[model samples]
Target: SVILFLNKVVISQVICKALLVPINPLFVCSRHIRNRYKRISASKMESATEPGESVAGKSTAMTAGQKKEDRMKRFRELHLKRNEARKLNHQEMVEEDKRLKLPSNWEAKKARMEWELQEGEKKNDCLARGEDYERVKLLEVSAEDAERWERKKKKKNPDPGFSGYAEAQLRQYHRLTKQIRPDMEEYEKQREACGEDFHPTTNSLIHGTHVPSKQGIDRMVEDVSEKQIEKRAKYSRRRAYNDDADIDYINERNAKFNKKAERFYGKYTAEIKQNLERGTAV
Candidate 1:
């Protein structure tokens, strides 16, 4: 019984020793480091909260007058900042204007005008001496005038040489004597069969017919001449307004006309005048 008890005791001690033995040194070190970090974090938290509490207490203790003064100081600082920014912007704008501004071209224009005046005087002197103006005017001839001159020259001399002239004349003769097409000949015969008594509207029902109409050049010329004469008469009437006698005559005539109008529509005029006085007339 004593040996059995001793063996059991040895077995219990061995189990307890095995349990107490360190499995890993790193795990023991990590646990110790974590506990230290926790204590330090708690102390840091307390320190941080202390300053925040003091700021809260100070802000709560501030008076209304002190708050107003602080607000005014902030506003003044903002205004000064804005003024400085504006001055910087204005300075930049002025610098940009100076850099981009163009110099005037008036001197160049004056020089050109003086040169043109001298050329004009030279041309006038040449004209007075009966010299040919063609050479002097060559520089001033525009593309339009040159084209017009070429067209006029071509019209005056269509065929430049004898061979060209002969060919053109032959072509003209052939065009005049050209044989008519069968269709056109048939059309002409059908037209003749219709007779002068047949109305164009009735003939058009079968086949369309185009008749040449006169342009009436004389009538157009007469109309234009009449318009020009009327325009001159109108101008004369307008010019007469500048004369004292004509003005007096016109005023007298207008006065007489107004009197006639007043007699004819006296009642309507009186009503209009009354409405105008009352500010009711449009």
Candidate 2:
């Protein structure tokens, strides 16, 4: 039974070696077999230690600690080169052109130059054919260009997020105006038709004194005004002070006190208040 057990273990070790995997540490035969295996391995190691008998270009003389230290040294030199860099003079760096020369509005300037060149080439052809060199620029901006400009403006004058307690409905209303593309030609025509005495304040269309654009909006507004206008606006629920009122109050009671104070001091400090609001106060 012991011999058969040894046969199985020998087969397993041979299989592990063939598979190039470590022999299982838990695998055990009797003490005698283990001792015999150790002796055979020792003899093999001794044979390998013979000069010119080892694997070519491989040395086994260095201890693990020595090998690890050499590997670390090589790694520091190869990958982590800060130690080598420390020896160089950082003060003697090549003078970099921090301010690269560029003409004012270089982007637009370059575009204009290219456009002019193209126009010069077209001018000769146009004169030969008796045609005028009309404007190459488009009147309407692309959605992407408008979006880019809007984004730039927003960066300078950022809009509040919904979470920031902003007026969501009011913001949405203002945003809707951007999407409304009014007929510029019709607008210009109307302006020309209007007499020289036409002021913006007196312009019926501008002030919405004209009939409502919607079919039945006039009737609905009139009907609503008769019933709901007085009832709904009997007492204003929302604050009715200047929309540009300073927000210095922390609580409801503080806000009421501030509102009362503003009424009395508002006239006296109006200019100062405006300066502060506009960030022009020294």
In model 2, how large is the Cα lDDT of residue 215? 33
Off by over 4 Å in 1: 1-22, 63-282
Best-performing candidate as measured by lDDT: 1
User: Residue 110 CA error for candidate 2 (Å)?
Assistant: 2.3
Candidate 2 lowest-lDDT run of ten:
91-100
TM-score of each: 0.17, 0.20
Say what the RMSD of model 1 is: 32.7
Please list all clashing residue pairs in model 1, or write none if there are none: none
Model 2 agreement with the true structure over 126-245: per-residue lDDT tens digits = 778776655322234577997898888878965323322246667756865676577677667666766563465554454554443463476558646774567646845544466685
Error of 2 at 266 (Å): 30
Q: What does candidate 1's lDDT look like per residue over 88-135, in tens digits?
A: 999999987975674477568779999999888887898999876677
Q: Model 1 reaches what TM-score against the true structure?
A: 0.17
